[model samples]
Structures are given as C-alpha cells and as structure tokens.
Target: MAEATEKKAKTKKKSANQTLVIVESPAKAKTIEKYLGPGYTVKASMGHLIDLPKSRIAINVEDNFQPEYITVRGKAKLLKELQKDAKKSDTVLLASDNDREGEAIAWHLKNAIQDKTEAKIGRIVFNEITPVAIKEAVKNPGEIIEAKVNAQKARRVLDRLVGYNLSPLLWSKVKNGLSAGRVQSVALRLICEREEEVENFLPEEYWTLDADFVKGKSSFTAQLVTYKGEKPVLKSESDVNNIIEEIKNAECKVVGIKHTDKVVRPKAPFTTSKLQQSAANKLGFTSRKTMQIAQQLYEGVNIGTSRVGLITYMRTDSVRISQTALDEVRDWISKNHPEDLPAEQIQYAVGKGAQDAHEGIRPTYVTYTPDSVKEYLTRDQLRLYTIIWERFVSSQMNNAKTRTTSAEIQAGDAVFRVSASKIVDKGFYRVIHLLSSKEDSTGSLPALKEGEALSATKFYPEQHFTQGPARFTDASIVKTLEEKGIGRPSTYAPIISVLLDRYYVTRVNKQLVPTQLGRMICKILVESFPDVINETFTAEVENDLDSVEQDKLVWNNMIGDFYTPFKNRVDEVMEKQESVKGFLDETTDKICEKCGKPMVKKLGRFGFFLACSGFPECHNTRSIPLAKCPMPECNGEIVARKTKGRGKEFYGCTNYPTCNFISHFKPVDQYCPKCGWFMVEKYDKKNGSYKSCINPDCDYLHSVTEAVEEAQKEALAKENQALKLAEEASKENQD
Candidate 1:
C-alpha cells in the first residue's frame, strides 16, 4: 500500500503548464484533450479504477451504510498508473461520465491520484466534449457532487448485500456458479413471469371489418373498432359476421362529425431512454449499439484540426435543456423554419420522478450539425449524431397542428368510427417528426354536418387473435424493468449479457427465451428463496438506495435493515437444509450409444452433463458438446471446459498434439453436417470478421467477423438494458 502511495505522489508533481484530465475511457480522453489544446493531457481510468474488492462483501451494515471499498481485483495496476499521471500534472481533473457511477469513479480517482502526488484534484463535467463546452466546464470546475457519489455508494453497498447474501442460497438450491442480484434477479423474474403468462394465455379468435371509403378522389380504409360502442362483445368469426350482416342491410350514414385542431408538440430532447428507443426503432440498432455510438459522439469526433465531443452527456434521464443550446436552436428555428416556431418558447415539462439536474442530450452546437462532420466520422458516428441533432432541434420547435376529422357511421344497431387528421402546419414534424408506421394523413374535408350521407365501396372482414404480452425486446424489457424500479441504467446491459453469456438465456429472433439452465435457476430462486423475486420487496430495496444517494439516509443503515433479515433467511435455509431437488432432471435428445433411451442430464462437480440415467448399468458420461468437430485430423467435438492455469478456456482438439488447434471463443453451437467440426471465429486484427475452427487439427478458417462492430452494438444494447434494470431496481429497493 505504501509503494502504491509513493507512485501516486510522484504523479501529482507534474508542472502547472501540464494539465491532466482523467476520464473513464480512452475514447473520451482523446476527445477532451484535443478540444482543450496543447497544455492539456488526457488519460482514461478504463472504467472505475477503484471498486469494492470482488473477493468479499465489503460493507459495514451497522455503521449506516459505511462502505469498505477496495481497489478492485486487476485494477491496482491501473490505479497506480492514474496516480503516476496525477503526480505529473499541476491539476488532476476527474472527467468520467456524468452520472452517479461516474461521480463515484471521480471520487475514487481523486483518492487514487492524490496518493501519488500533492497536486490539487478538481472535478470537471462537460455535457459535451466540444471545445466550447470543455473550456467552459474547465473554467467553472465544480466540486464533486456528493449526492451522486453517495447514490453510487449506496447502490454498490446494496448490491453487495443482495448479491452476497442471496448468492449462497442460489448455490444450494440451484446449481453452483449460478447467482442472483437485486436487479438481475428481478429482471429474470419478470421474464419468467411473462413467459408463464404467455404460456397460460388462451388466445381468443375475433373478427374485425375494414370499410374502404371514397370521398371523390381520395380513398381511405378504417378498421372496425366496435359494434354499437361495445368493442368485440363478440367472441368468434360468427359473431363478427352477424354484425356485418346488420351493417350490410342498413344504409351507411354519418351520425356525428367531430373535428378538432390540436398541436402535436415535439417530444422532449433525448434522455438516454428516448435516444435508445428511437435508435432501436429507426435504425434497428440495439440500445447498446445506440449508446456505444453515442459515447463515441459524446467523447469527441475528429473535426479537421481538432477532435471534439459531438453530443452532450449520453447517460441522462432529464429533459432539461441547456439555455445556450436552447438559444441557438431557437435562432435556427426562426431563420430556417419560421412557420415551425412556436409563438413563445416552448418549455418541455419533465415527468415526475425524473432526474432533472442533468441537461438533456443534444449536439454541442446547433450549427455544427452531423453533416458538417460527415467526412470525418465513421458510419455509426454520422447516424447517431444526426439523431441527436434532429431530436434536439425538434424539441425546441412549435407543435405540429392537425385538422382532425372523425366520422361516426351509424348502420342501424352497429356504429363504426373512422378518424382522419390532416397536417395544418408541419410544425416540429418539418424538422424531426419521428415517422411511425401508424401515422395517418389528413386533408380538408367537404363541409358535412351530422346526419350526412357518405358513400363506401367495399367492406372486408378479417379474423384476429388476441396476443399475449409481448416478449421483452432489448428496448421493451429495459423500459419495463426501469418502470418497475429494478436497476440502474448502467446495469441493464450487463445483466442481459450475463444471462446470455452464462447460457441461461438465448435470443431467438431477438426475443429472450430462457434456456433449460435459466429456467432451472428461476425455479430454484422462486421455490427456495421467494423473497428474492418479491416485487414490493425488490422495489423497496431500490428506493432505499436512491435515498442514500439523495443523502436522505445512510448506506450502512440501509444495508443493515436489509442484510439482517436477509442473512437470517439465508442462514435458516442452510440450517433447515431442504434437500429440494429438481423434478424433471436435465435431458438431452442426444442418442445414448449404449442405452436406447435419450441421455438424461446428471449433476456433477462441473455442471449438468449428459449421462445414461441407467448410470450403474451403462456407466457412460460425456460432456454436452456444443457441436461435433468435423475436422478429419482431430475428430474432436467442442466441449465447454474451464481453462487451467489462467482459467482462460477455449475449445481444444480432442486429438491433442496431432491436431493442435484451440479457440478462446463463443461457439456457434452448429455442427458441420459433413465435416462435424465446430466452426470457430478468428480475426487478422487488421481486417475484421474471421471465423475459424475450435479444433486446432482442422485446417478450416473464415474471417469477416466485424468483432468490434458486433461487440459495440451488443455492448451498448446490453448497457441500455442493464441501466434500465439497475435504475428500476434502485428505485424499487429505495422505495
């Protein structure tokens, strides 16, 4: 520890002419340093330089959420490096992301940097890393926001309490290596619960009629909503047919005409959630992809002579606009879109329970649009910046006005309504009206009072089935988890990634489906530890953590309130020792070589593997191979195995030295129908996507992996989901 301190001291002795800014990422560092000019040097913390040691639950439950954080495993060296940098600079500025976690990182960096040098440490936050924002932020360096730091600490402590206390229960009830979290566990429960609901739902078949109507030259179609204002009182196609028969016999006439002109204002500027949702919808980019791209945009883009942050902070829940940016936007609207400007400045109202302290995400300058940087940015950079720019500008514009006309047709006992809305003025839509598939277009209609006759061409009837709840999309799941207060924004992706990484969940057509292992884990948590997944209990814990952040409560006390009862529950389970077992054991469709029956899964020191249920009789056990290796030389299959030494695992050729091939990679889990060797991915490090074979003995190889591209997207999407879950979990716990 003394040696570590010495390194930090040396780092603090840098000259005043040299200003070093430490951020959470190298990408951000590059962007900021470029904008700040020659006197400034930037470095990355590579994400939290200090964290609670992974080896233990470091919380003082009795001391009002007193946290005992340690330099996290594998981070000591990195922290030492930061300390050295700190000592070498006149002023050390912590420029991590602007969020609770980022604040904690900034605090940790202060300690890490100070341990090396006597140089002053300052906290600086730039909503955007552009030259103007960066300079302004540096000029007005604010003290570290303690509320954010406390919030982060509270969350960490709470997570440790939940994870450390509950994980042991999972080990006993579920399989080893399996664990649960305050956010992750709740998310799992939600998915599992939704899956159950879907399974239980009996789809009801109903019919709907669409009437194609013509008014002179224009033709429009409207779907049947209800019969006599009572929607779907009918259950079957026969009932729908009966309604249609009545409509056919009666003359179609307009009973009531309702027309109203309303302004459809633009949505608030991009909160992390809104940006992610829009990207998901518009670009088919996952939430993770959106953030990764946004991060690049926020950190900085190379613009001719200098690199700059393109957009404001990417992780925020607030819709509050920065006054300067708002002013620029207002000016742009007045000059370029006079008609779209509101009569007065439109102040967007933020939702209740939103974090409004942070500024809404927007481009650094309204004029320095994405197009201006097109030549310098990568493909993703352009797309994301465009989104940010459009969204910000739209947020300040006037509402779109529409002359809406609704016609209620009364056909004897059955009444049907069709509505049309015409854009009176483009308003905000002129700049950034997010076009959705269901958008309806309207125009001036002839003056028609109630009791007017209308002509219709063809009436068509269609059958429909009620859908069960939607499966969690990367976006929907994140939103749902957030609404329920399950987790922080940063955690959403990690939880999802962990589930998939651990083989607990699989994405089938972008939908999360619990694998057998995932299902088993859920069942165990539910049966053995019901409290872990309790909605109110989970939500309360999250709220409690938030309370700690707001300084309304102490972290240690929060942990104590939770850990005391939780520890008791865990201990009780251990002492009582319910020899609870799986009802339907793991089974594989793989044909058993000896026995005719399919192989049944057997529990072992490693994990669930295929073994003859007639163990004593057959005595055959084999690793559940991902795919059979087809390499003629190795003739080995890819099996999930832990690596020795460094614990870094990879697929090895069963043929050993004769076929010396190994892969540290995720398997496609597909077998070569002809060769039988599992195809592995590789990269030249220069080009991109490189798919190869796990068996070293095999000569097969393929590339074009686009590893960074795939990873960036997945990472961002995971981050988004994790963040939502974490935020929700925090709220739930805190409440």
Candidate 2:
C-alpha cells in the first residue's frame, strides 16, 4: 500500500468554510467570544472535560509505559456538546493555555472530538489574552504536542493508582469514613510533622537590653551589643541581668555616628507564593481562596460595565516582566507619578529557576482598576484584583529612597547601636503601600555625623525566650508545596480540602494544627509507608510524571516500579496486621465493665468502641454510646438514631432534633476546644457521613464551604418558610 493511497483512505480533508476553536474553560468563553467573529465557532471544554474514572484502579503496571484513561462521569454531556461542535466545523483549533497541562488538555480534546474529517485538528498556544497574541496563535497553528499530553496522562494515572489502591486500604484499616490521597497525603504528612516539631520544641530563657538617647532635636533607640568593647552573646536571664546592672549605673553617651545612602526597591509582581501570602495578610483569605478568586478573575469577570480579565496568569512562579507590559506600566507611572517613573525602564534579571521570557505577574488589562470593578465583584474578588493591579503597577516604578542614620553609644565599655530611616522620596512605594511600611517615626540626624556625642535619655532591659517554629497554614503550605514541586496549582485546594475532611489537620484561630486523626495518619504514612510520604519521593514522582508529558518515559513503567513494592506491602500488612490497628492508635485504656479488666479500644467497621482485653475469651464488648449534648449551656444527653431506613447511626439531640444537635460520632460532652462555643454535629451529605465540632461560627468554614458548593444546606430553611407562608395564604383565602 502506497503512503499516498493510505492517507487518502484514512480520513477526509476539512472544508475551508468551517473553523472550530476550543478553549479550556466556560468562564473564558465570553472573553474569547469577543475576539472571534462569525466564521468561527468558539466553545469551552470547561477545563479538561475528560479525566480518568474514579471507581476502579486502572493501570498497566507490567509495562514500563502504561497510560490509564477514563471518561470522567459528568463530562459526558460536555463531550457530546464538544463533539457536535467539532463535527460541524472543518478545522478544530485547540486554544488551551501554553503550559504542559494545557497541552495535555488539548490532546485529550482531540482524542475525544471523534472527527475523521479532512480538516486537520490543530493546536494554538496563546501566552496571553491580547488580540495580537490570539491572531499570532491562529496563524501558527501547531500539531498537538504529544510529550505534554503524555506527561498529563502520566500524572493522571499515577494519582489514580495511588488513590484507587491506597484509599480502599485506608477504608479497611483506618476509620471507614477516612480517605487518603497522593498529593493530599503528602501535604497532610507535612502539616502533621510540623505540628510534632512545634510540640517537641523547648523554649530557652534569653534577654535583650536597649537604651534611648537624645541629641539636639532627634531621639534614637539602640540595642546593647557587647561587653568590654566586644559583643557579649548572653543566653540566660542571669547573664543578661548581670550585664544590665553594670550598664544601669554607668553614664551613657553617643560616641560615634554613621550614615549611608540606601534605596528600597519595590517587590516584583507576585509569584504564586507572594500573591497567596499577600491575599492572606490583606484579605484574611486562605491560599486556596486566593487561587479560586484569581482563577475567576483570570477566566474573566463581568465588571458590570464590561467583562474583563483583572489579572494576568496566576499559576506562574516566574518574575520576568514582558517588555510590552513593562512599557504600558511605565506609561501609567509617568502619567500618574512623573517623579516615580525611572528615567529608563529598570530591567530585573529573571529569578533563579524561572523560565525564559514569561513575564512576571501582572494584570492582563492594567487599565481596569479595582475601584471601577468593585460594584460588580464580590468583596474577595475586588480585594485580590486590587492587590494584583497595585503590585504590578508598582513593579514598573522607580526604587524608593531612604536616608539612614546610625549612632553607637558607649556606657562603660558596653556599646548600644541605634538606627532610624527617613523617607527621602515615596517613589514606587506610593503605589505599593505594603512594601512602603516603615516602623521608625523619628526624624533622621539633623547636623550630627560620625564621632558626635549625645546624652542618654534612659536604658531598659527586655526579657524574652526563643519561640518555636510557627505551625503551617494554608498559605504557608501552598508555598511549601510549590517550592517542593510536589503538586500543581489545581491540586492545592483539593489537597487542603481532603486533609481537613479526613481530620488530618484542623484549623484553630486560622492556624493549621494536626488533629489526633491527622497525626495518626501521618504516623502510619511515615512509619509504614515512608516512601509515599517522603518529600523527595513525592517530588521525584511528580518529575517522572512530568517526563511522561515529555514522552521521555512510559507511563506504565512508572506504575510498574510503584506497584511491586506497593503490592508487597499491601500483602504483608494484610496478613500480619489482621486488624488495621496500630498499638499507639488502638490503646488499652477502656476498663471493661464486665470484668474490670483494661479493654483495648479499636475502630471497627461501624464506629469506635472498646472490646474486651481478651476478645474471644471474655466476649465482653459493647458499643461506646454518644454522650450528653455538647452545648455547654444545654443539660441534655444524646442518643443514637438512624434516619428511618438509612441504617447509618447518628447521635441526635436528646431534645429530639429541636436543638438540631447531631453527629455521626459521639460528641465529647464539652464546649468547643476552640471558639469557646457549643460543639454541635456537622452533617455533610457528600463524602462525609461523620460529624465534627469545627464551630460553625469560625472562619475555617470559609475553606470548607467552597467544597460544598454543589450541595445546598440552607435550602430547608427557605423551603420551610415558603411552606409556612403557603399555609397562611390558604387560611387567608378561606377568610
């Protein structure tokens, strides 16, 4: 068979009249719609309309390269719509993002489009949303890059294998309601390990001494540096006190002064980490929350008057600004602050590990100010957009200037250093206020210079102890995850969500603290499955998956290496570990009521309970029942009740649902350890059949609330109100 004959018989060429353009998300539909005209049909895949199946573990582990593919359950309708559109169009244009994931999405779209038409399926990589970029992408339609596609497929299969194989094992061994994930488990392990470190840390006593001095019209503060003309490093309270006594009686005077010219540069536009931290500090948002809002802004937002993208791409970690965006920003700066704009553009070197030429974070459209979009956006959307816009704008401005003055005082051979900064110019700081913050309020040295003398106002001793490392929060975790390359932008939210749902970590006062369950899970992962929880292991797995996208390694080969050890471990645990119970987790605490013997507490299929120390011998076991109402003010005990036929037992309010107190597990008869409020049952219809007392009034609800967007909880309240109104209307009609 000749090659020409085979090509002719395999597929028909596309007609010149029809053109199909496929984008990644529905939210982007309108944004791209405006750019495209009538001859083209534009549709969104709603962000990867196809994905691996959830029900079973699908992997070809024997082969070095195995790729598992599945039709995501709900995307069928979306696929049908896309397929319909693709068939009608002569040419299919894959207009997804330029990243590896976007490339993978385009390939998947092609696989599912099912068009054998002569019009060839093509790929377009648009780095940005401007009209020129779009036009250039259309002109340079490329074939589906197979390496990126394989990388995505590799990641999908790897995650599926870990989840599918590990989740069931968790169900069997741990609490039935619990689940484990790949990236999520790693994140959980990290948080749990951090909590342990914080717990085990020992604080040491230490003290620092400072002195206040006055010269002419200027007052300055300095800290005690050393003793006998040498810096004395004191570690204990007694040592610091001894030094303080020597200095307390001695006369203090400024013996020397030093000055230096300084410039403070504005921070470059936000990378993913900086943006998350800023969002958290300024808006009291979680990293996930920031990302969600940024995604919506990136996709497109209806700013009432006009739909616009408030921010540039949010997934990037690079800090290289494009010359075009820089030029436009410089123009804005010159128009607003002629003094702030540098004589020429200040070109910053690309950050280490940053890719070439991809601009630093900036607003996609700089002209759209947050104030103008306030009425149209929610509080959160506006807050994030404002920060992004301001930061990007400031990045283009000139460096801020500061005048610095330093004075070293001598008090009987013990020296104290004082320093203060005065703003010479607001510079770029006027645009980026967060970067402009300065603590010193006093004016700089008037006529004072080096070798000048001044009188001492007062001296004071301050006592302090070294503090432990702070616990991980969502923002911190996101930073860690990105830095480690353990997960991607999309996985952060789902990872945090899963960790919380599994009770692997809990939030208290906005701090992420590992729960007992979370710690236990971490212990299990660390001790038994060290490879799975290891940061290096996770990053290596991710890298290999990235390689799959590059087509450098076969997906099946990755799974093969993973399965041998995994299966061996599973079998080993299945045989010897008859009960998915660990000695530490399943404790011998519960004293048997029948024999007064210590009974061990182990989690069974239904729930947690204490069985006789000698289970078969004593045969004395009973269900640990729910306790009294957790409400501190209420004086009622709870009883177990199943919803009519749903054999799932739940601890209900003794007040018969009147108090609305319920939980799948027995609520500890105490006030919420946090919030100081009543600990009530939390009933989640999807994924979670258990209950927790994560205080409804707490802000932690913000993170989890996003998880239940597909479910409606307050509907019953509205429904009941509507029902009551209808009943009253019937009475009014009769009257």
What's the number of clashes in each of the models?
77, 18
- Candidate 2 per-residue C-alpha lDDT over 161-185 given as tens digits, one digit per residue, 9 for 90 to 100: 7776666666666656566777888
The total of clashing pairs for model 2 equals 18
| Cα displacement (Å) at residue 683, model 1 | 34
Give the per-residue lDDT of model 1 (tens digit) for 613-709: 7768788877777665555555576676667786655666555667665566757855433355566545342432346655555666552223334
- In angstroms, the error of model 1 at 687 is 42
Which regions of candidate 1 deviate over 4 angstroms?
Answer: 1-16, 58-70, 145-147, 211-232, 240-258, 408-417, 433-458, 527-532, 577-598, 602-735
Estimated TM-score per prediction? 0.74, 0.74
